[model samples]
Structure formats: C-alpha cells, structure tokens
Target: MTPAARLSAAIEVLADLEVRRRPVNDALRDWGQTHRFAGSKDRAALASIVYDALRRRASSIFLLGADSPRAVVLGMLRLGRGLEADDIARLFSGERFAPDALTDDERARLEAPIPDMPAASAGDFPEWLTESLERTFGDDLIAEMQALADRAPVDIRANTLKTTREALVSALAHLSPEPTSHAEAGLRFHAGDDGRGPALQVEPEFIQGLYEIQDEGSQLAALLSLAAPGEQVVDLCAGAGGKTLALAAQMDNRGQIFATDIDARRLAAIHERLSRSGVRNVQVRVPRGRFDPVRNPQVADPLADIAGTVDLVLVDAPCTGVGTWRRNPDAKWRLRPGALVERLADQATVLDRAAALVKPGGRIAYVTCSLLPEENDDAVSGFLERHADFESVAPSNVVEAAGLPHLAEFATPGGGLLLSPRRTDTDGFYVAILRNRAA
Candidate 1:
C-alpha cells in the first residue's frame, strides 16, 4: 500500500476508536481482519500513524482547528512527522484510495504559525488532568507531559537467574542494546523511525529466557522492595508475575514468594514465565472465588496462613496507568474521571490487605504506574491514616536499601519516589515503602 493509502486506513481506525470507544489494538485488529489484503508492513504502518495521531491528538486538533479523524491525521503529518505542506499535499491528492484533497481552509491552517496553547492542549493530555498533573509536576508539567507524548523505547530485564546483564547485552548485540541508566539488570532498545522496536521475542536469547520485557521503572519498583534472600514475600497483586519473577531472582530462589492475584485469568501466564525463567521459589496462588475482604476475608485465598508473617508485601495496585501513555497513547484519551475514583478505592483495599500480611518491621512497597497524586501520595497518606502500625519509609532509605542511591534525587515530598519520562527517562511510576511498626 502507498503512504497515502496507509494514512487513509489510519483515519478509519481512529474514527472507529472515536465512535466505539474501544482499545486501539482491538480497533486495529478488526480493521485488519476486514482488510485481509493489507500486508504486514501496511498494517504496521497504519498502526504507527494511528498511534502517533493519538499521542498528539490534542495538539493536532489545536493545529488544524478540527477534531475529525482526517484533520487529526493531516495535523499529525505536520506536528508529529514534521512534514512540509507540499509533502502532505502530495499524500492528500484526492487520488484513488488516498484521502480527499485538502480543503483551502486546511491548507491555510497547516501553513499558519502555531498559536499559544494551554498546557492540556500543548501537552496532548486530557484537560481534566491539568490540575492533578500540575500538582504532581508543578513547573515541569508541560515538559513531563510532552515527554510522555513521545514514543517509548523498549526495555528488558536480564533474567539474573539464568544470565548476567553483561552476557545478555552481548547476546543481543545485533539489536544495539544499552544498559539502562538506573536498573542494573536492564537493557534498552530504541525503536526504528517507523516507530517499531526490535522483535526481541523472536530472538533466541529471549526464547531461552535470558531477558524479560519490562520497563526500567518497573524493574526499579521491584528493586525498591528489597526482597532479600530467605525473606517471605507476598506479591499481593502479582498479575502476570513480572515483579514476582524479578523478586525470585533477587532472592536467588531461596525464599518463598506467594504470587497471587484476585483474577485467576491474569495469573495464567505466570506459570509459563516462571518455568521459562527457571524461577522455583514462587508459589502460584490462584483465587478460588471472589476476593472481597469485608465480606469474605481470606476466604479460599492461598495466603491466609501467612497473615502477619510476611517479610515484604508488594502492592502493584491498579490505577489510571498514566505513566504508560508513551506506549499506550490511546489509554490517555480513554481514561475517565470515574476510572480514577475506582482505582483509588481498589488501591486502598489492596494496601489494607498488605498491611495485614506484613510482620513486625516488615515492609510494604506501594507501587502504581500512575502519575496522579490521588493514586500515589494521597493513597499512601490514606493508607497510613487507616493503619497506625505502619509508618512511611523515607525515599532516601528505600533507595539506599535497594543500593540505588542515585534514585534519591527523584524522591517525592511525601516520602515516596516518583520516576517519570522527563525526570528518570522512564515510564511514570510511584513507589513508597511503609514498614509495620508493631512488635
């Protein structure tokens, strides 16, 4: 397919997303199934255009003075791809399968100088998040949000149980991998100009479980827990067990990790991952029934016996996932106000469960892949108010315990650490460690 045709396809996908309010992947998949003639390259190109448009959706709308799929795609050509007017005009020539010829108004708008935009529009994020983001980033809100609007690099953590970081990096040399700035076991790969990263999953090293595709921020969050060898740990929300596998490597397969999630379906992939990575210390605990602490506390739960005895509990709670916008640009637009409120409630419940599981002097690492203060600082504050036995651990101390003193710079005012695209060159993640003070 020609570039113009690919752009036309992207516009259709975006329109589908706007009307159906479905995930970008779902919309793209349905489009591909219907247009079976589109080659792999064509589908990938269409996906890139659609994602880029979403990433710059607000800015594109501002530039073109319209929110239609065609206008947004055209504006992305100028704002995202940095195409000249002539270059865009060539693509929108009204030829067969190409977008209709650009109207005089569109041409004029494209050629006009950019106007001053509000932070929400300039940052390409929803207007509702402006105040929350401002509170979190203050002076650096636009820069931080702009960084999120950009593409993310692919990151993988070397499975220390099977290979060293240096060995893994050498094996993947063809991909031009680099050691991550903060995570000692992480390697980073830049995406191509087409916005696609190396197919690491197909690499022999990846197949052999030499590395796991994890964000640098996620690797650091797992490290912050400091799950030492021979310590009993509970991965309270160990969905897919990414962090659970990391914790297994940290413990050298010596201590037991009770890895479980409320939804058994989410934990299905973990067994295969654990086997591939040679992780033996993790015990997979699938919930047998609904997990409502108030109604059915620890009912049919595997970790019931270990209550008030765990050395560490990692609560990787669900949230708006704002930090992952660089990779999931569509989610930033799909997010709604009600979703944030639901996440806050879920976070509180998980934190309370973690408090019950932790032994005296044991740590509870509260983690969220969210930039919202409501899910980060506010949630932690609320947790502490409810659980008097738990005290907030200083970010400096948490990083020091993890042997990552450099991360002290990203410490939040509320004693947690915040990692962002602009600050840490990583996805947005908030981690706070609270210790049980009761004897």
Candidate 2:
C-alpha cells in the first residue's frame, strides 16, 4: 500500500480504538484482517504512524492545531516523525491516495513555532498523568518523556538454562538487530528493520522457545524477585506467566513454582510455552488448583500450602499499566485520576496477601508496570509500616547484587528494594524485594 493508504488505515484504526477503548494492536489486527491486500510493509508503516500519533497526541494536536487523523499524520510528519514542512505537504499532496488537498491553514500550523509545552505536552503524556509523572520523573521529566516517545525495542530473555546468548544471537542472525546481554539472564534487542517482524516469528529460535519476547524492564522485575534453585516460588499474579517463566529459569527447574491467576485460560496457555521452552518445574494452578497432571492439591488454598513456607513469592501485581505506555499509548487517554487511587488500593491489598506466603528469611517481591510512586513506593511503604515483620532494603543493593547499576533504593520498616524505569532502561516497572524475618 502507498504511504497515503497506510496513514489512512492508521486513522481508521485510531478512530475505532477511541470508540471501543480497544488497544492499538487489537484494532490494527481487526483492520488488517479486513484488508488482506495490505502487505507487511503497509502494516508496519501504518502501525508506526499510529503509535507515533498516540505517543504525541497532546503535542501533535497542539502543534498542528487540528486533531483529525490527517492533522495528526501531518503533525507527526512535521514534528515527531521529523518530516520537513514541504515533505509533509508532499505526503498529503493530491497525487497521493493518503489525504485530500491540504489547505493553507493546515500548512501554516505545521510550520508554526514550538516552545516549552506544559508537563503533559512535553512528556507526551496525559494530563491525568501529571502528578504521578512528576513524582516518578522528578527533575529529568523531559529526558524520560523523550525516551518514551520513541518506538519501544523488542527485548527478549534467553532461556539461560537451555540456551546461551551467543547461541540465541546466531539463531536470530538473519534479523539484523544486535541483542545486548544484561547482568541477569536478559538479552535486549530492537527491531531496526521494523518491516522484517514476520521473519522473527517464523524463525526456528522462537518456535523452539530458546528466547521469549520480554521487555528488559520485565527481566529486571524477575531478577528482583531473586529466586534461587530449589526454592519454592509462587508468581501470585502470573498473568501470562512472563515472570513465572523467568522464575522457573532462575530456579534451574529444580524447585516447585506455581504459575497462578484468577483467569483459567491464561494459566492454560502456559503449558504450551512450558513444553516448548523445556521447562519442567512449574505447576499451573488455575481456578484454585485444577491442574491434576500436577501434584498440587485442589483443597489447598495454595497460599496456605506455602504460607510462611515459601522461600520466595513474587507479586507482579496488576496496575494502571502506565509504564507500558510505549506499547499501549492509548491507555494514557483512558486513565482517569480515580483509577490511580483505585490501583494503589488494589496494590496494597495484593502486597499484604502475597507477603503472607513468604517464609521467615524468605522474600516477597512486589512489582507493577506503573511509573507512579503511589503504585511503586507508596504501596511498599504502606504495607511495610503496617506489617511490623517486613523491612526495607536498597534497590541498588539488589540491582548491584544482580550486577546492575544502583538507580534508587529504600529501606523497609524491617528492609526491601524499589526500582523504576526512569532509572532503569527497561519498562516502567517498580519492584520491592523484602525478606520476612526469620523465626
């Protein structure tokens, strides 16, 4: 498809996304399925323009003075996409199927002055994210916002137990992006040839499960859990088992790890992943212990089975998912101030409950994809202060222990680790690793 057609497609997808509150991926998928004639390049270009628009929605509107998809496409071409004014005009020219004739007023706005915008505008984030963004960002708000504006890299964690980084690199060699090996067992790579995404999915490496598509930020959260071989670990809120798989890799497939969630279907999906990845240690507990192929008891509360008995428990809790703004920029518009408050309350409840399963000297690590301090630090503090047994520790210590830089730290009432994406290059994940006092 022509550039114009792709932009037009993005506009249609964005419109649907706004109305249904569906994610960009879903909208794009539905649209793509409907338009089978569209090739790989067309989809890639369309997704890029759409996400770029979403990333800078506030500023795009401010710059172009028009909020239509065409205006957004024009604004991105001028400002975010870095296209020159003439180029933008050309892209929207009548010769193309993209947009209708660009008016003089639209041209003027594209060339208008750009100055210091408000925090939301500068950060390219929602106004609702103002206070939380300030707290998490502190003085370097602009730099962080700029970082978020770019398309996200595709980072993968090598299943260190089965594969080495070098081996994984060789398997993914046809793909050009180099993978950077992190301190823990993470291999970070970006899709420079964005158009070649399909080749990666069909590769034997992905088929073999030698590497899994996880963000570097998420790998940090998994490492933050600090699971060891033969230690009983529970990923209490193992949504799709990203961290659960990470935890299993850490345990060296020697200990019992329970992959759990309120959703049965999600847990069910882990089996194929486990089988492909050659992981044998995890027992999936869906709907309160329904996996009979495993030894876990249906009568067991699961938490009670390990209450004060687990060497490690991880609560990669659900939140506003603010940190994942890069992948799902539309979420920013959907988020309301009230949702932040509700998320904090939810985090507190999950933290306290997850902590209960930690054995004396065992640790329960709390984590969120949110960049908000209310979700990151405040949740840890509220729980630590109320629970006399748990204490705080420096996050730098954990990162250093895991061979990472000391971006930030906090001591628990009793000791724990807190980390955010602004300090870490990964996702906007906040992790606190706390040890339960030994009896």
Candidate 3:
C-alpha cells in the first residue's frame, strides 16, 4: 500500500479507538481483519502512525485546532513523523487511495510554527496528571514528560541462566547491541526511524533462551529485590516471570521462588517462559476460579508452606503504567483518575500480602512501572502506616548492593528510587525496599 493509504488507514483506526474506547492493538487488529488487502508492512506502518499520533495526541490536537482523526494524522506527520508541509500535502493530495486534500486552514496549521504550549499539552500528557507529574518531577516536569513522549529504545536482558551478556551480544552482533548503562545484564537496541527494531525474537539465540525482551529499568527493579542464592523469595505478582526469572538467576537457581498472580491466565505464560529460560527454582501458583489468588484459603496455597519464612517478596504491583509511556503511549490517554485509584488499592493489597509472607527482618521490594506519586511514594507511605512491622530502607543501598552504585542518585527523597526516562534514561519505575522488624 502507498504511504498515503497507510496514513488514511491509521486515521480510521484512530477514530475507531476514540469512539469505541478500546485498546489500540484491538482496534488495529480489527482493522486488519476487515481490510485483508493491507499486507503486513501496511498494517505495521498504519499501527505506527496511529501510535505516534496517540503519543503526541494533546500536542497534535492543540496545534491543528481540531480533534478529528484527519487533523490528528496531519499534526502527527509534522511532529512525530517529522514530515514537512509539502511532504504532508503530498500524502493528503486526494490522489488515488490518498487522504482528502488538506484544507487551507489545515495547510496553514501544518506550515505554522508551534506556539508555546501549556505544561500538560506540551508534555503530551493528560491535563489532570499535571499535578501528579509536578509532584513527581517538580520544575523538571516538562522535560521529564517530554522524555516520555519520545520513542523508547529496545532493551533486552540476557538470561544469565542460559547465556552470559557477552555471549548474547556476540550472537546478536549484527544488531549493534550495547550494554545498558545501569542494568548489567541488559543490552540496548535502537529502533529505526520507521520504528522497526531488529527481529531479535526470531534470532537463534533468542529461540535458545539466551535473552528476554525486558526494559533496563525493569531489570534493575528485579535486581533491587536482592534475591541472593539459597534465599527464599516470592515474586508475588510475577506476570510472565520476567522478574521471577531474573530472581532465579540471582539465586543461581538454588532458592525457591513462589511465582503467583491473581489471574491464572497471566500465570500460564510464566510456565512456558520459565521452561525456556531454564528457570527451575520457581514454583507456579494460582488460585481456583475468579478469586483472590494471594489470600485464598480454600485452594492449596503454594506460598502457605513458606509464609513468614521468605527472605524477600517482590511486589511488581499493577499500576496505571505511567512509566511505560514510551512503549504504551496510547494507554496514557485512556488512563482515568478512577483507574489510578483502583491501582492504588491493588498496590496496597499486594503489599499487605507481601508483608505477610516476609519473615522478620526479611524485605519486601515494592516495585511499580508508574511515575505517579500516588502509586509510588504515596502508596509506600500508606503501606508503612498500615504495617507497623515494616519500615522503609534506603533504595540507594539496594542499588549499591545490586552493583549499580552509579544509580544511587535516582533515589527518591523518601529513600525509594525512581527511574525515569529523563533522569535515568530508562522507563518510569519506582522501587522501594522495606524491611520487616525483627521479632
């Protein structure tokens, strides 16, 4: 398909997403299913345009002076795809299968220089999140949010249980992988201008379980768990075992990791991943039916036998994922205050559960892929208030122990560490290490 046609399709998909309020992937998939003529490249290109448009949705709307899908596409061409006026006009020339010719007003907006925008619009984030963003970054809010608006580089963690970082880097040499600045086991890859990164998944090394696609921030969060060998650890919300596998490697597959999630469907994928990564120390646990998996009493509790004996409990709690904007930019637009509230509740629940499993003097590493203070600092503060037995530990100490001493500067004022796109050149992740008081 022509580039213009691809843009047209993207506009349609964006409109569908706006109207249906469905996920971007679901909208794109439905579009592809209906338009069978669009090949793989065309679908991918359309998806990219739609995603880029969403990433800069507020800025695009503000510049174009309209909220229509066509206006968004036009603005995205200027901002995200970096197309000149002539370039955008060419794509919208009303030629065969192209978008309708741009109106004089549209052309003028396309050619005009961008005006100084308000903090929320300038940062391409929700207006309601301005306070939260400010709370998180203070005077640096614009820079920090703008960093999130930018495209994310692909990062993968070498499965040290299967292969060393050096070995995986050699195996995927053509991709020009570089060691991540903070994550010792991580390698970074730059996605091309077209948003296409190397097909590392199809590589023989990946098939043989040499590496797993994980963000550097995520790898560092898992490392902050400080799961050493022969220590009992529980990945309380181990979705797909990304961190669980990392913990297994840290333990050198010696200690047991009770990997469980509330949703069994999410837990299903972890089994296959555990097998592929050669992680043996992790035991999968799930509660029966649609119930609270962590605290369910009727079902067999895999963690029951190890409760109060666990040295570490990693709570990769569910959140609004404000930190993952670079990858899931569309989600930011969909996020609501209600959703944030729900995630806060979930974080509290998971942290409380973790507190139960942790032995005296044992630690709970509360982690979230959220930049919102409500989910990070506020949640931790609330947890500490509720659980008198637990006290906050300096996250800098955890970073130092994890051998990323250089990252000590990223710790929050409350002793938790916040890794952000602007500050750490990684995803927005918050990690707080809290230790239980000894009996």
Give the Cα lDDT of each candidate: 0.92, 0.73, 0.88
- Lowest summed-lDDT stretch of 10 residues in model 1? 290-299
The pairs that clash in candidate 3 are none
Q: Compose the digit string of candidate 1's lDDT tens values, residues 1-439.
A: 9999999999999999999998999999999999999998888888999999999999999999899999889888998899888899999999999999989999998888878889998999999999999999998899899999999999999999999999987888889999999999999999887788999999998888888999999999999988999999999999899999999998999989999987788898999999999999989888887665765676676778899999999999989999999999999999999999988888988898888899999989999999999999999989999999889998988899899998999988787999999989999999999999998
Runs of candidate 2 exceeding 4 Å displacement: 193-198, 288-300, 405-422
* lDDT of model number 3: 0.88
True-structure Cα RMSD, model 2: 3.9
Candidates 1 and 3 compared: the better one by TM-score is 1
The C-alpha TM-scores of every prediction are 0.98, 0.90, 0.96
User: What TM-score does candidate 3 reach?
Assistant: 0.96
What 10-residue stretch in candidate 2 is worst by lDDT? Answer: 410-419
lDDT of 3 by residue, 45-110 (tens): 787888889988988899999989888888888987788899899999999989999999999988
Report the Cα lDDT for residue 422, model 1.
93
Looking at model 3, residue 167 earns an lDDT score of 89
Worst 10 residues of 3 by lDDT: 289-298
Which scores higher on TM-score, 2 or 3?
A: 3
